[model samples]
Target: MHYKEAKHILSASNGMNLYRGCTHGCIYCDSRSTCYQFDHPFEDVEVKVNAPELLEDALCRKRNRCMIGTGSMCDPYLPIEKTELLTRRCLKMINRYDFGVSLLTKSDLVLRDLDLLQSINARSKAVVCTTLTTLGEELSRIVEPNVATTRRRAEMLKTVHEAGVHTGVWLCPILPFLNDTEENLRGLLDYCFDAGVEMIMNFGMGVTLRDGDRQYFYRKLDEHFPGMKERYIRAFGDSYQCASPNSAELMKIFQAECRAHGVRYEPDDCFAWLSEYEDKQVAAQISLF
Candidate 1:
């Protein structure tokens, strides 16, 4: 891990990544795509030492409060986060300033800040987003080796839900010929439904492969699923979006299950919910007045 002083913290849309690289090695991580242009190795996490201070300044200067998002580019709860506590410090600022937050992660370490998340939710909104790609623990280990398994993440979702915080799941990057099966999809959706997640965001039963990430993913495929790399090369042939052949059938089942379970499956609706800032305390104050 290394530290860098970032000049800015929040994006135009109010999203921020406290760290640049990720240690929770998801083999299909889109952030590792060459389009992102990382100067260093993906696991050599680049900690934004000034993230908390910069976020405080940014939030303080904003005329209107909005959701402060994180973990889009890198998982905030990476192993380094346990000691660095940058994400925790930033959350303290967000809570102090009464700003909403939308945090995305694949780690159960997020449970450490349950109290702060609850506090923020009580004031405004605090929605937790977790990714569920593979349901089988062994498959999860092979794919997202360093991060929490899908079952553990589902448990974390339940924990967040019981804390009165809404949760969303990113059911994405489904590898073709690997985990792009109806069984895998159903198993993952069962977890979401059981955990009481408010919404699920799935682009399709497919994963994208690009310059940096494609090479890495193919290398992993070679290592774990022999002859799979050749198959991908033969099938995709430098294509960017590698849609699984089961995409149509799987999406039908996905939508049907979500509807049956009363879970939000529309991507736009889920994103709107995540981005919307609701101040329940403010509403209560106005009611009292």
Candidate 2:
């Protein structure tokens, strides 16, 4: 990883990616898309040296204390974070400002910030969003290699919920023929529900493939699933949305399960929930006064 001084940190939407590229090595990472236009290799992992300072400035200048989001474009708790502590520093800054945090990652390292997350939740909203592709550890290694396994992520979610912080799960990009089965869906859903996630986002039970992302995904398919690349090309030649053949049945089960379990499954509702910020500490202070 290389460090560089950054001019700005937070986006207009209050989201920040402290690192440009990732080392988690997810085979289906959309961040590798050509649209993002990375100057260096995807694993080079550019570090924003001034992320904490810039975040402080941005949060201080904000007229409203909304949710600060991260780990969308890249995993904030990458291996580099063990030494750099940039994600931790930024979380501290977010806590210092009493702003809400809604982070999405596949790493169980998020558990290390339980103290800060609990404090933030005490004062304001602190939502933890983790992406779960499959519950099979072996399959997880093949796809989301280099990151925490599925079971470990579920444990992290349970830990966060026990700490009184809200959590959500991103159930996505179900590789058409590979993990788009009833068994895979049920295992993933069971993990999310068992962990008591506030939301389980399922956008059509499919994956989106664009220029750069599609090429890499197909290559990986060829490497692992042999002839799967040709199958995909035959099924979705040049198409962006690669909805699984089981998407219809699987989505039916998904929606029904979410309804029975009372978990949020609507994408819009989940996004709205993430954007909402509640200052419970201020309310409690007002009550005391």
TM-score, one value per model: 0.98, 0.98
The local lDDT score (0 to 100) that residue 205 gets in candidate 2 is: 72
Candidate 1 lDDT for residue 142: 93
Candidate 1 versus the native: TM-score? 0.98
**What shift in Å separates residue 60 of candidate 1 from its native position after superposition?**
0.7
lDDT of 1 by residue, 165-280 (tens): 98999999889999999899999999999999999999878998889899899889999999999999998899998999889999999999999988998989888888999988
Per-residue C-alpha lDDT of model 2 across residues 167-257, encoded as one tens digit per residue:
9999987988889999999999999998999999878877899989888988888888899999988998998898998888999999999
Which pairs, if any, clash in model 2? Answer: none
lDDT of 2 at 39: 94
By summed lDDT, which 10 consecutive residues of candidate 2 come out lowest? 201-210
